[model samples]
Target chain A: MTESTNTPVIVLRGLKKHFGVGDAEQYALDGVDLTINKGEFVTIMGPSGSGKTTLLNVLGLLDTSIEGDYQLEGRAVNTLSKRQLARIRSRQIGFVFQSFNLINRLTVIENVALPLTYKGGLSHIKRLKKASEMLATFHLNEREYFLPYQLSGGQTQRVAIARALVNNPSIILADEPTGNLDSRASHIIMEELSDLHQRGNTIIMVTHNPDLTTYASRVITMLDGKIASDTDSLLGQPSVEFKRPLAMVVRPSTDNQAANSQTKPVVTTLSKVDRRKLKVAVRKRQQIAKNRAPARHAEEYHQ
Target chain B: MSRFLLSSHLQNARHSLRSNRSRTLLTILGIAIGVASITTIMSLGDGASQVVAQQISNLGGNLAIVRPGPSRTNFLTDITVPQGQNYATSTLTDSDVAAISALPHVKEIAPISVINSTITGQHSAPAGTPIVSTTPALSSVDGLQLDVGQFLDSNISQNTAVVGSNLARIIFGTTDALGQTAYIRGYNFTIIGVLKPLNQPINYNNIDFDNAIIIGQDIGRQLSNGSAQIQQINIRSDSAANLTSVVSSINKTLSAQHFGDKDFTVLANSDISQPTSELFYAVVGVTTSIAAISLFVGGIGIMNIMLVSVAERTREIGIRKAIGAHTTDIVWQFLIESLALSLSGGFLGYIAGYGLAFMISTALPFYPSFNWQIAAVSFGLSVLIGTIFGLYPAVRAARKDPIEALRYYS
Candidate 1:
């Protein structure tokens, strides 16, 4: 998990992001100071309203009107013009949003080629070729011509990932990538992310689920717009205890049929006892989802 | 702003606009209407000018006209018949005609005296039938062809007449009206000849000769109480080479004849078509400007629809910005979409406008002219309107905050 030179890819110092002014002011990100090294798969976990997405957005350079310094690869972000920052984002940063914000009108290949469109020199044919190649890595080559709505939840998320990596950005920022996926789909996404991390790409992912952090080399937890815990370990050890067993907790399922169809091949290889455990885990996650569904809606509204 | 990015943006703009095919087409239709009006006006105006020019060229280079108008009127004010006492005071006398005929290189002289009177034969003519009183030389000067019988005799005092084919039909109910008597103001005059049909109604004379009754100057003076209004004089030079010298000599002689009043306009060649063409242009210019106003309103329609489009595509804008599209790129995208709509409209309008012009030309004496200048102005106007009307909405899209924009789900 150790990067050879330990070169810092991102640096944030006393960064503050606030909404409104004076009496009505509220901080979305309050004085965050952190340094992420090259090739680190850092997972950020926090409850709702804890500023995880805000931090991710700021780190991705999607938000730059903050109080303090932000440096990406040793260049201060504040000094760059909006056009320059956008250029940097196009060339160096890849973003994955929770909703899998694939343009609904575009075909999957077109959606994946979007980032490369902002790139200056690459021809249209070359960009689509690169997108096709990226889709192949995600085993999504056959679905290139299909629209986003035509793809299953897992496939849509994979296409989103393909779009993110198509530009060969230096860092990937994912905000709740599996937030809408079922357990088996989440497992597949996590495996793909782990494969990317193994190949030495810097990835920062935000997630509500604690179990997903096991794939990360380091973990950070936020509370009330500030980081409450940061740890560099082989496996993430979140300070907050979850209601379910650590090994048994699963991603909340949004679509049961899609989840079942996707997990069928993997489920058949498991033993009878493990299959039963999987079913039990699924049931608990469903119950947790029902109880927490309204809160999730409220949180999205606040965001 | 590279070519690749621009092409991609154009492709995306096409895709997005195609998604709302009806709205795009409607917007394009608005622009097309504006362009169509302009093209139609321009084409028709040019056609009228071309017809007048064709008429003047047909008259031959040696011909010169002397008309009762201000010798030195402002060209701008004279475009629509300048308001003045020149018409009431200016007169062409017989001595003026005699003096012009004595000028060197003057081949012939024909003075036209218009006497307003109703003629009656087999049928009484319309109330305002023009009774033109001229000499026998008018046949050669005005290019009057004798369809069946002889022209007017040289005897100035003879009570003889000639009838245009149309007038003959209106009076005698036949084209061969030689030796037929026609009554004008209680005087019976024998129709000595029947003139050929002249299809051209719009000419320097502004008279449809096909509908005229021509009589000898002496009898016309008796009918009009010896004070006939001499409206114009047609002069033919000996040859095309001597036309300039003849015109100058006649101008000097006529000015001296009127005691240097110079209340006459001597016109030759293309100069003869100027007044008529200018009058045509003024009328067409007014109608064209009205059509231009409608085009401006169409541009406003484009602006209104573009604003609506920007609002609906807020989320799309957000997604693009979030994916690293710059503010200028967003502006270019929307601008290109509007340009596509407007340019397509322009192309459609150009074709439609010409169609309308040609259709209208069927009822007109001339056909509408088509040229590259009209096409260039039309397309240039469309591009300008698209850029201008598309700008505000594009800037509005570009000004959107990525965070707030992404929050827009629709």
Candidate 2:
């Protein structure tokens, strides 16, 4: 696992995923070879059953049964054990599903910070602080303690996004992020991801509506687990451009930096000014948790 | 599994139980009822024996009662009574008391003779007024209290009698009815003294002193067919420390008198109260086992509800696993919830059980005894039931595939 600056974050070659047996068999992902570099906002567009989600799941390292040379950051993912694959999934990949699957009984912060538990380094308080900062970025600071059942469709998706980004994963794989949301909510979510892309975070989104492809740096349409068409010149040229100065762009590391930045990852990416803001965010959240600790104690047995 | 993960599992379990309030309460109620039954039975058994033991201890601690019945000591052997036996075989006689009195360290001997006959008072005499005849040493041997009249004196051959307060009031129209003529079967007797009211009605004698017509052994023989059959012989040792020597001497004398048959028992302290105590333990054993069956059924009910919960929360399990929960974590969640339910039921049932025991004690003679050992047992049994029955559902929950669980709609 060499720390190479020019290495691609995701590399898939001759990927084939088969389902069922004999005559009844069909390929969910037949033969797909794809390469996604660092900070490339790749949008996968295809109709239903076009293997769009299967490709995203394979890239996310969630299901590893495919017969292919699937290398993530110069390391062969197939060679890695289940525990190591889970570690890669936790630190490198953040998934946002169409259903916005938040745990029923857990609160907003609990759902957001769940990925950090698998990564395992910071205390519960520190993890909560980091989750709170992510939620605050999406203007959901006050809704941190709310349950998933109490949230609307749009709010639930935003909380799910916050949960995905809390672990500071290099790539965000969204399988129909706005599939359940209204047009207005969908626009707000796309704008947040567009801003994240301009700040050099790689995003691979799967969508049914082609209107969402405008936010992608490279729009790749799939047909029968094969690339039907690809707008390849947009690899470094995303349609949605940021007005903010690119001078504050942080160098995104491709090595195993995800597992090491336990104490702070947001700090690792921020400039001096934004870094202090994150510190204050972490401190304020800790204070709020200290204040809410007594109330949480009362509700602990009741819940 | 870290401390935070364990705490999270417990918190999720509590939340799951709290979601469906009525089902949780009903299940808890079932467990509580089961727990209360066993606890009440055990407490009452302990309490009754405790009260009897305390009462026995209160009586100078130097007394031992010898009754004419089947020897409980020789339980394995088949003992029979003479033919045509009524109430109990009259195996004791007045000579037994006299012979026991001659033993060393023997202070006093009271021989009890029984005669059940109707009495006619000036106003009214109770239909079942029993006549108990004993020697003048009865007051010293038994803790008999007199209200305002004198007991029968052995020096006098006069047909005198002492009536219980209730019987005296009925037969003579007053407890102070001194020298009032009362008809016993066919003989008329003068009531010399009025006995005190004994609140304790049913004793080992199976006789209520409050409704008894007490007379001397001479009158008892006359009331019967000129033959007095002693029912029991009560001996009072000089001191509690002298009980062993006194009992051994009495046993030796009785053995010789019975021609080495040893059918009669010479008891001291707890030995005298064994028959009733053993009866209590038997009753408790039968009732506790029945209550245990109810608890087992209640445990099954918990398992049934937990299985339903696991099935219903399949989607929830998927969401948790997707967010990074291990398979063992799901199992821990449900097990904790079941434990919470039964343990809560146990706590509530313990309080209710003591309440039941206290209510029963007032209706009966003995008081309910309380001990921490039974409390621990009751609580521990409910917890054990919770864990033992909750296993199947928890394992089922943990074994579910994450992909399939997520695909489930409900």
Worst 10 residues of 2 chain B by lDDT: B76-85
Q: Give the TM-score of candidate 1.
A: 0.75
| Tens-digit lDDT string for candidate 1 (B1-410) | 79998898789778978898898887788778888888987788677666767866666778898987656455435544532222374477778888888888999889888777789988998886878888899888977898878788875337788888998998899998988999988898888888889876666665668888888888887886886567788899988889998888878887887788867889887666653534465665565666677677778877888899889889878878888999999999989888887888899999999999999889888888989999998899899998998999999999998878878887
Question: What are the models' TM-scores?
Answer: 0.75, 0.62
Candidate 1 ranges beyond 4 A from true positions: A1-5, A232-303, B61-122, B127-144, B148-163, B178-193, B213-290
DockQ, per model, reads 0.52, 0.19
RMSD of model 1 against the true structure: 10.4
Write model 2 residue lDDT over A144-253, tens digit each, in one string.
Answer: 89999888777888888888888788888898998998865676577667667767788899987545665666777776676655555323433343211111212225
**lDDT by residue for model 2 (B283-320), tens:** 56566666778788889989999999999989777666
TM-score of chain B of each: 0.75, 0.72
Cα distance off (Å), candidate 2, residue A196: 8.1
TM-score of chain B of 2: 0.72
Model 2 chain A lowest lDDT segment of ten: A242-251
In Å, candidate 1's interface RMSD is 1.0
